[model samples]
Target: MGNFATLQPGGRPLVRFYLAFMLWFVGRAIQAAALVDPNVRKEFNDLPDDFSFSLGAAFNGPQMAIGKDSNGKVKYLGKNSNIVPQVKITIKSMEALFLLFTFRESTPVANSRERMTVEGNLSHACACVRILDIVQVYLLPKPIAKLAIKRYPKWSLKKHTINRLLINLRAIIGF
Candidate 1:
């Protein structure tokens, strides 16, 4: 009792334990929120379904030939020289939208295993739509572009992410 202020031998260990427990609890809570938020799920479901394109096809456009000149100077190429195929995805219902969103979020494109699963799901879902096509595209990173190109001969340089929901307001009703 006389030296209680300076005799807390186990106080530091207890404090550390409490902090660790709190952090773990908070992390788990955040993960749970990400998994169950209705708004997040709805946002994910609003992605398109009928659209499809390939990166390799984009590279095949004439733009690739318009590089720097022999003197190492950039050159401007004509507008018609580059032609990229446009993909238009159409969603018939809310259920289809949800399915697409789940597949995209769960399977990250960079991971081989995840990519395979996502591609499989996309293919399956595309079959349900009258005019949907699932096109395979290779991911190209800037730093490892050469290595990627060497590894996958047909890979393209363009990369894209599904960041927005392209919903046809006219087609969709209250949900």
Candidate 2:
């Protein structure tokens, strides 16, 4: 019957395990803190109003499909066919910031005309502008809006252009 102190090997492993666990825990805490810092949130919120974002480097492919008949028959429509795709972009404004994203082809269209028409209609629709991470889109707080205007004196600050700004910001930030 040896005393526990005499069992040196077991105590060393336990101490090492505790130290490793503490190091891992500390590393995770630091990472989380960096992500949720108030300054980071504020910086994101304060991004330039003209910022825009795109899905990828290349231009998005044209979305197309075959025409459908009233009888639910598959119509083999050729390119520039009756069927076309729709894309929608939505921007929501949070406190001193704007968040923008896109929803595509949410609506069904019978032909290219309908698709083009819908797109045209949406072009004028204020909601269709695609700025991402806007602190405030509509009725922005006077100061914040003013700050944005000051940042981009020449730009229209429209949704489309704003989205482009956001896309660029995302790229610059590497986020």
In lDDT terms, which candidate is top?
2
Question: Per-residue alpha-carbon lDDT of model 2 for 105-124, expressed as tens digits?
Answer: 11121112132222323432
All candidates' lDDT scores?
0.25, 0.27
lDDT of 1 by residue, 14-64 (tens): 433443343233222222222333332232234233222211112111111
- Can you tell me which runs of candidate 1 are displaced by over 4 Å? 1-11, 39-175
RMSD of each: 23.0, 23.4
Candidate 1 RMSD to the real structure: 23.0
Error of 1 at 115 (Å): 42
Report RMSD for candidate 2: 23.4
